[model samples]
Target: MTQTRRAIVLLSGGLDSATCLAIARNMGFESYALSVAYGQRHAAELTASKRVAEALGAREHRLAMVNLGQFGGSALTDPTIAIPEDGGDGGIPVTYVPARNTVMLSIALGWAEVLGAQDIFVGVNAVDYSGYPDCRPEYIQAFEAMANLATKAGVEGARMTIHAPLIKLSKAEIIALGTRLGVDYGMTVTCYQADDQGRACGRCEACRLRRAGFQAAGLDDPTPYQIPER
Candidate 1:
């Protein structure tokens, strides 16, 4: 019998992560979808995560509730800090949670070790991102190296691999690819401050990028938005 190759996919219930999950499944992996509840302002995130996991036919779905809101460093984790609507000026945006990817990938690594899986997938993009320092290709490489050295499984020759399939992809390219793979963007939420109904605020940076991507892809924008008429 052929052994099932398992992969831990870090699913944020957003556009990129959902597409990343689909890509892992397409690569013949038994995907274990992992979502982190790091005290994000968007309450709809976890709900969307559940939707994506079920819709994409993940082998298993798990939620890790680690409240990073206690830190109060980012807008996503702290309600006091306002989510910017300028669509990102230059530097890293306020939505860039401190050490978020590190913590998320660390959780993924621990679960992978327990599940006897060596593959982990993250959907970080460089091109059309919010300028999060952790989303860069260099950061992904460094994290993979750390994963190989930090775990007991790695010492036993089970070298871990961190897969960032959407790292270099533009938002339009990603949307196009995910569309071809049957991803329902309407089911996913990327807004920094989505309402309980999972409707996106069309003015935030995330919404701007996502809306632009759909336009560039020449695809129908199926995402539900709560935009005030100007």
Candidate 2:
């Protein structure tokens, strides 16, 4: 009998990562959902990630806390800067956490090594992302190349891979794909400046983009927000 291949998906509890987890399951990989609590403003997303993992039937769902607060350059971890409310038309927004993807991917690689999983899936998109350099396709490719060389599994001749299924997909397409995968958007969270109760501020850049995606897809966003009612 053939065993299912294992995949470690970096589930951020947001729409994209939750969709990626579902995608990994659909692709016949035994799902292991991993989340990081890296001192982001919207820590509530981690709770959503846990829900998504259970909903998606992941074999394991783990949340590891690492204080990236020491790296205070980004708005996500730094309280000094505010999360962007308007479109970030300027250079890399203040919310661009430096080396965030690098750090997360490194940790995911470590977990995948221990789990003996050859595939690590991350839901990073360039098209809809608010100009996060790490979300770019080339960044993912470079990380994949470096990860394969950095891990013991790769050094031992086991081929390790990083999967970014939504790298090229637009926000609307991502929403559509997640819908097709039986993903419950209500269980996912995407607001970067959500209140502690998970109600979106609806004014932050993340909220704006998420609202746009659902509008473009003609889907009612199930995410709770404070705007429409306010």
Candidate 3:
């Protein structure tokens, strides 16, 4: 039997990453899901990650801990920094964990090399997003180029591709596509400050975009927000 090509999907247990995993699987890849515990503000994020990974039928799932919190540059990594609720002043928000995507993708790249895979899937969007610099297309392209150059596989002329399938899509479009791909949004967490139970605050930028996406898609949101918003 011909072996299925394996892929490493960075699953944060949020809607986008989970959807990315579904997309990878739909593309005929035997996906190995990876979730990073990077000292996030919400503990439920990884819990939701494990749940979504299993629910999505990943060939294997692994959790890698990096503790970027040690660096303490962002709200998610530093408890001393408060999570912004005002959406921001049209600037890159504090929610932008410093070098988070870069770090996570690096970890995925290492695993992908070990697994003899050439693809890594990350759920980053430019449209309807928190305006993170790392989520831009140029950044992804640069990372892909760097991956090919730095890897032994690339030296052997094998190319490594970083897949950001949701980069150009609006949140509503992502929701629609993910729904069609059978992603259960309820199993994911997207809040910047989700409680231990994985319920949203309904005030953060992430929560705002997620809620609006469901509304724009005309789909009933399965997310459980805090008391007043619930």
Candidate 4:
């Protein structure tokens, strides 16, 4: 029998992350899903993370809490800043949490070392994504280099691979691939301002991108949005 390689996947309970988890499983890795509650306003995604992990048959699911809210920088972590309802301006929006992806990946790197996992999966796409610095391929590559240098596993000659499977794919292509992988989109939440019950605002940047993706893919969006009465 072939031994299954273990992988640590950063599951955000969002469309992209969930799809990444599915892809990891499809690759024959024993996936361990990790979700971080970094003081985001729309924490409903954490709930979705658990559901996605279970639905996708992750070997283990873990949630780590870090109060990035205390610093109050990004709109997602700080309630003071308003979530951009009119979609993002051309530049990087206020929703870019400072060093968020770096922090999350560092945490994941630690766990991966402990689990003897050489691979880490993140669902950061350059296309059809908010202009977050950490989501870019350059950032992922730099981090991968840093990980190999920073860990004991790397010193022992283990090659740490950071996998961003959806990095180049457009949102529409991501949705189509997830659908083919039998992912249940209804269980994921991609809204920046989702309600307590995990319903999307349908106007935030995340919702807009997700809506467009489904439309472009010619697939019905199963996201539960909190639409006001007409």
Best by lDDT: 4
Report clash pairs, candidate 1.
Answer: none
Q: What would the per-residue lDDT of candidate 4 be over residues 15-47, giving only the tens digit for each residue?
A: 999999999999999999999999999999999
- Residue-pair clashes, model 2: 0
Residue by residue across 41-114, what tens digits does model 3's lDDT show?
A: 88798999999989888999999999899999899889998998886899888888998999999999999999
Which pairs of residues collide in candidate 3? none
Model 3: number of clashes? 0
Off by over 4 Å in 1: 227-230
TM-score of 4: 0.98
Compute the lDDT for candidate 2. 0.89
Better of 2 and 4 by lDDT: 4
lDDT of 3 at 53: 89
lDDT of 2 by residue, 21-103 (tens): 99999999999898999999898899888889999999999888888878799888998888878876768899888888888
Against the true structure, what is every candidate's RMSD?
Answer: 1.1, 1.5, 1.4, 0.9
Candidates' lDDT values, in order?
0.94, 0.89, 0.93, 0.95
Q: After superposition, how far is residue 6 of candidate 1 from its true place, in Å?
A: 0.1
